[model samples]
Target chain A: MNTTGPDSPSRRELFRMIGSVAGGAAMYQAMSTLGFAAESTYRGPVDLSGAPRGASVLILGAGIAGMTAAYELRNAGYKVQVLEYNHRAGGRNWSLRGGDTYTELGGFTQQCEFDEGLYLNPGPWRIPYHHRGLLSYCKKLGVPLEAFVQVNYNAYLHSSKAFGGKPQRYREIKADYQGHVAELLAKATRQSALDAAVSREDREKLLESLRDWGALDADFRYGANLLASERRGYAKEPGGGLTARPLPSQPIGLTDVLDSGLWQGIPSGDRYDMQTALFQPVGGMGRIGEAFARELGPLIRYNAKVVDIRQDVHGVTATYEDLAAPGTKLQARADWCLCTIPLTVLAQIPMNVGAALHAAISAVPYSSAVKVGLQFKRRFWEEDEHIYGGISYTDLPITNIAYPNTGYHSAGKGVLLGAYIWGQNAMEFTAMPPALRVRKAVEYGSRIHPQYPAEFDNGIAVAWHRSPFTLGCYGMWSEAARAQHYDNLCQVDGRIALAGEHASFIGGWQEGAVTSALDAIGRLHQRAIARGKKA
Target chain B: MSIRHVTIRLALAVLGLSAAAAQADDASFMPIADLGQANGEQIYQHICQGCHMPGGEGASGAGFYPKLAGDPRLASWQYAAVTVLNGRNAMPPFGLPEDRISETRTVHLSDAQVAEVVNYIRSHFGNTYADTLTAADIAPLPHPR
Candidate 1:
């Protein structure tokens, strides 16, 4: 029964109206189905062609944002000097491996004991397809990339309270949930429960679509059948001769599936940022930073910690301590300064920026996060569980157990991301000694995989809060904080402008840093050219 | 909780009460307080190991997670307890024992848990502080800022 008249708008038209009524965000969300969202703003490389001769820019912090800026500015003929606090480049984009010892804020040194080739990318591990800016740089830098498996069908999804605390396979949960939801929707359509929502013509089409999508029977019921087994996996395999007969697997009922709450794990792979076609740099995520370091060479000054940042009408002078040398404070002068020091650290340092920018810097707080990389005696996850490279989530203190994306089907040892936790848990992990954290990770992990204790060899944990350079993980801006201070933070205050993940819309992402660097440089170049014209 | 959620909880509670399951493995849903095998270290391992990291050395990245091991900051137990209960800045207010975080039950820890975890951090990982704190020290603390 159709009740729509000529004036009645379609669903797309209705969402457009809602978008117009609500805002751009609402419109964006509404139009997401129409393929409107998720296009990277980076249009290849920045063309910084017209740079004034000998216009030097002092960049603080040799992080991705700073390096991106320096890499572009130097190519455009600007004299660039980057002061990095650490001996190595890539501030947060770091990878820890064997022989690397990290001494955090309070002087607790952690010596990484992972086998050769096995490393922990403590920051920025996965690169999304949509992050074209970083990806383009990767391609330009000749960094070899490989697929980062976002979802493994055979990975386990365990809840502390569900199914007698047993883990369910991703395929089993996804198949059962989809099959049940489809069956219910088909039933609703057949009973005309959705008469107002779907037209009669659409109803028949929807029913047909549900059957195909849900792997439902002709009667619209999902049960123990070959059709269901095709999506969920078969109990018995069909082969040649006597073993040719196949047995179908039984799907969990809708109630049980919903009650298990394992359904939460199903849609993570479907999210835009976490979708398929994700890539990780070959070897480790730090390869990109290392490549950037290789590209810049001596332009980057290592072991220089900026103690003070001051700017006059003429130029900006930053006083930095040579960590290797001690006692003496050296100064670097430039026409302009692009500081990428995290606000958490920058707030404490004396900088003569405007009150608004200073307030903006102090307003935004950084997140606390902890990650543990456990080296196992063998790749038991691959050998026993058949989970090649994906995340297995649990409610235990260790939030996720991410199997290594690389080294699939390789013999010998492997590393697993035992836990990647943030917020309160991070603070807690921040308090435990490094050895204790590894022991707890092993203990918590053994719940999901009983092989953890026996197979666990050595482990290292990184709590972002303890790092001397960066006291937290990343800038976590509240909506109110972003609304009030985001523009101020990003704005060029005199000869000083900030560029980092914190300066962009896409915070906590490497792309944000890259794009924000490009955007900051473009604006800074225009100002430089204007100043050059006046001179 | 909804009826379904209640049923799930009841099922979990039954599993929790099973003596056989408790005897079988530490993985079983035992109480957080019950699981502490003496020492502030074990308590810290059970509760604090998730985020503070396995090592009190603390994780490092874009920002600093001030190292608790050998940290001079724990000179005052009051400051430590307050930080745990009320949570500072980006840290969420937590310690509702057993992870039941709801509107009625907004906190994630008891006073004793806070003292134990805090003391654990102060004492372990090359730290030589001979200080101990109790639930009384933590009970009067304000909510995390």
Candidate 2:
């Protein structure tokens, strides 16, 4: 007779769930015993207010960094509000569902290693064994993990005439050309070694030297490629490498790395390894953001897009228009504001402050990207079981491909391939009509798996450049940008703190965003304490 | 600074146009897309409340803790489907009996009912891009037992 829509479980029931099947208590005990908690607690939440109880903080852009700043500040007992221009949070970090498929359109992959899994970014993750923030946060949130397919190894380069395995008329090409490439690879390896050896402080000098050498090496390689083709009678050879032809040296130019897989053994150990670059959350990365949002509860108001930011000597006021209701305007006042919006969009924002802030923001630059997600009707990669995971397609001009089979329930019937393009290629790729884009993807995909020509049934792609909400992806650092602005980009403007992966020393990586947010939180806490002294 | 100021002004102006372009509903305050799914709370109560619970707290004790209330994993609809159909860990499979979905009435929830519950949960608890869960979303997942 008493039907109250089922009895709500008491706290005891919750605790019982933890003790029994959920394994919550056991996990907690393990975490504590293993000193995981101790290590995590050392980092601690950023100090909110050193002296008083109440302080206000404003965060811009609801991406990982802004969300993290809010989490830390709110947990530390500071009033926080996040204003996002986009209709939703998670900036360039986003996932979409289409026709029974989950595809990541933005910054997709992260590697888990050690407590702080150094993010082996699919974007700029060429670094050796560097999972830091990605792994640490997963541990913090109690998420499960799976191994990352080591795509770094086993890449084949298609040359101007043939695939990398054996160039046509290989015996005819002058030996100096091969030696030149080997020398350049060795130099790159040595420079990378030097960069790794020094303290984080002295990395700029090494980076500069490496950049100069890289340019020279690329130029020499360009000349060598032309000569190799012409003198070695390669006119009849097949044009193979993606971007097989090289361009003149300029401010920003892409060059080919050594085609051989020798770099894997180059022996420059940083902090981690590919074997440990594990990914796969118990659910997925989106879960992390959800956990952060749930903990904050209603504090995170969706559909509130901050339009304008105005600050005074006393406090900061953020002007936001409710995205759900266009005509409505909402204002929130805070003592501090953290802006984690990607630099690309941030550069265009209408600021109440003057040119100095503009100059500071303009200093941060972003590279464009077009992520193409192709879903095949069947797993064509399985044809060559040796290349079971759908080979990286490394030799092609395209980014990479994968068979996402690691999850517990994956059918292994479908194949998900993505191309991470940047700069002009990215712009061109995104600008191309969707139909043309699909055709080009199919053409290239078929080369690797003959079945792809016919087996490909349906696909979807996101030209982020066209998405008005998120104009483009994260910022990639230029050589000069790194030397000039890496340290300064993370600096807070009074109560305004900047946080995002682009704000970190390692620009264009999720680790950069989370790490920078953590750094900003630390600084905000310090400022709060300093403010107490001033009071 | 001038360029940015002008850009913002232009952006606001453009935003105004875009807003006008959007089809406005009677409840102008609530999004037009959200209004369609606003009435799903009841469906969640009647059909889903058994496993996921009434307040949407979910089955926490006995054997498997299928937290429906605020499990962060529910943010993505794909993750939401896995447990609802396959029955992860100790939770029994609800959508399909023998490896494959027998018919359109997968998970014992009709397309409308699924949409209603999905809307209820997403609107009330977590963030979902769309209001209603389409039949395509609850379509037979490629992977079976």
Candidate 3:
């Protein structure tokens, strides 16, 4: 298929069609229920007359999984109480609204192609159309989908040459710019010590390509090709393709292929491209947390740090301290409890009957990620052809960035770009102070822009690792913990329910959180019915 | 001499005009596979991770690869015909094989079977994402990649 033709349907038009149809259906439903309000909110307490004997449910954490489970269980008429350690909910799915614009600090993008009439870009960018559940959720949410531009990925090996000034694409420079890195890597593979000692030719080639890569205005196809080539071991075999070698087995190159090919699955043209949809919702991603607060209402008590969850074969009792008012302590009795807190936090949480449960909770493993958002005074890439947006280099602290204010309002002037640091770098970034982190980001950005002092400014930062309740961004499996443990994490332990992204078999993401919550609710409902029969 | 000079100028003008027109005509139809375009390579690098993956085993944040091979979705030949057109929970809408859209234009597949790479992804990664989604039964995906 030729991509440069004019007759193709723009992604915006497709989304418009989807939006009009979906919006019409939703509007029709809203009209039919115009006069109706939901029924009374009293879902009956967990007393013997209401909740069946030996049945009580408590949910901790107000994140997506916890909220989903609580909402579903409540709908099923199960007596439920949700306990959240944080003041709000939505977990990592955070949105920040300042001025007239809303920016999501976490989990920004979702893909709608997987599910018809869906808006899936929850964390920054939209997913590829292949994402089924996220697309389905988009259809459920009634948000139209968009596309990110599909382009090749490129990078420079040298730090000084590629860093600071303006970002550039690969083609704008001489075609031979990236050839040097390939040559060096191939040579290094055969001669280990020689690889460490750069010859004049290697150094010259590196500098030349760095200058050209920096001067070019084309998308770096290196990352994109790496995504395709890696699967086929393109990098494993030398000289097959530029992406054919280095990190032969992993998609790390592909991951940098485009921090988010938010446009890879959608239509052509910027009209409906995802650059327009990326935003941080007002307040925090936690504003979505307000939804839980609405449903849970006054039952949610803040600063009520939970100390223990103990069941005496009769019912479940929870002990906590009301940190809000000193000397204020409270105890709640329920037929059941749902523990949504992280297993790390759960281990520290005092549970009397905990030998087995503690072991299971402690066994779950999690990976950490660091996100740093930089608010710049101006969009420098717009001013210089040499500086392409979304430029990547190996030496920088942050490898990915996106131009967020690319909408009608953004005259391509001053814009705030979001930067992501993952894996080891993320861990390191989390340890730094706000000023230091900003300084590092600027320094990294300057490498791409020699004139960084003129184009860049300062901004704020947040470290998810330092967050008390979250402990880490989400879960990642260690070599020791196989897929079976993840499968078992979804299991319901009698009346005690588990819900959280970590508790999910899918492991680390917002989708895991939702799926796990939905599963827990179904299991809890079944348990409630079974207890009723026994009674 | 005067006549010859005028004729030469006219000939040069004609050549320049034809060259400009040719450039304009060719502008709208850039081929899908450009030697150094970088966009296709970038798309292949980033979006293919979920289905075809870095190793092309058809696995990533999503499930396995067999589900992607010869998928019915790519039959439309649109840029969005691959993984995202059908959809995945972990995958997004735009980066699928069918979603290979250009900033200035669109790409439609020449044939339905071109999506066989999805099959290649499946064969390598084993099975995932679909339940009994046979190569023969894959319906054409919605959006072109």
- CA RMSD, predictions in order: 8.3, 25.4, 25.5
Candidate 2 accuracy as lDDT: 0.47
Q: lDDT (CA) for every model shown?
A: 0.76, 0.47, 0.42
lDDT for each residue of candidate 1 in A1-535, tens digit (9 for 90 to 100): 2336532333334334433443422101011011112445789889888899889899998899999999999999999999999989998899999889988765568899999999999877888898999999999999999999878888888776778878889899988988887787788789988777778787777788779878999899899999999989899977789889999987888777777767666765776777888999988999999999999999999988888899999889999888889867999999999999988778767899998998888766566677899999999999998899998877665767899998888888999999887534455566666787788788778878989889999999998766777776777665556788999999999999999987887777888889889999899899999997322
* DockQ-better candidate, 1 vs 2: 1
Tens-place lDDT digits, model 2, residues A355-391? 5555556654333455555655554454443343312
**Residue A505 in model 3: shift from native, Å?**
4.0
The number of clashing residue pairs in model 1 is: 41
TM-score of each: 0.80, 0.53, 0.49
TM-score head-to-head 1 vs 2, winner: 1
Tens digit of lDDT per residue, candidate 3, span A1-535?
A: 1123342223343345434533422111001011112121113221222434435467776766676666656655556677665555555655433222221122122111111111112232333333334344344434444343222233222222222324434331212222222333334434544334445455445334433432211322233243333332333555556654554322233123222221121221132222233223222334445555676676566655677777766567777766667566688777667777766556566675434555556554333344545544454554543233332333234544444422323342343333454433444454444455556566565555544556554444444444455554555443233343544555666557677766654445455566566666666666666666422
Interface RMSD of 2: 23.3
For each candidate, how many residue pairs have backbone atoms clashing (under 3 Å)? 41, 21, 141
Instruction: Give one digit per residue, the lDDT tens place, for model 2 in B1-145.
Output: 1243346546666677542222121111222113224334533432343334445554311012254656676677766665555434222234533223221112233434444556567666455446467767777653333
- Point out the worst 10-residue segment of candidate 2 chain A by lDDT: A27-36
Residue range B23-108, candidate 1, lDDT tens digits = 23333122333443334555455445433656676554334446677677778777777777755544434543443332211226
In candidate 3, clashing pairs total 141
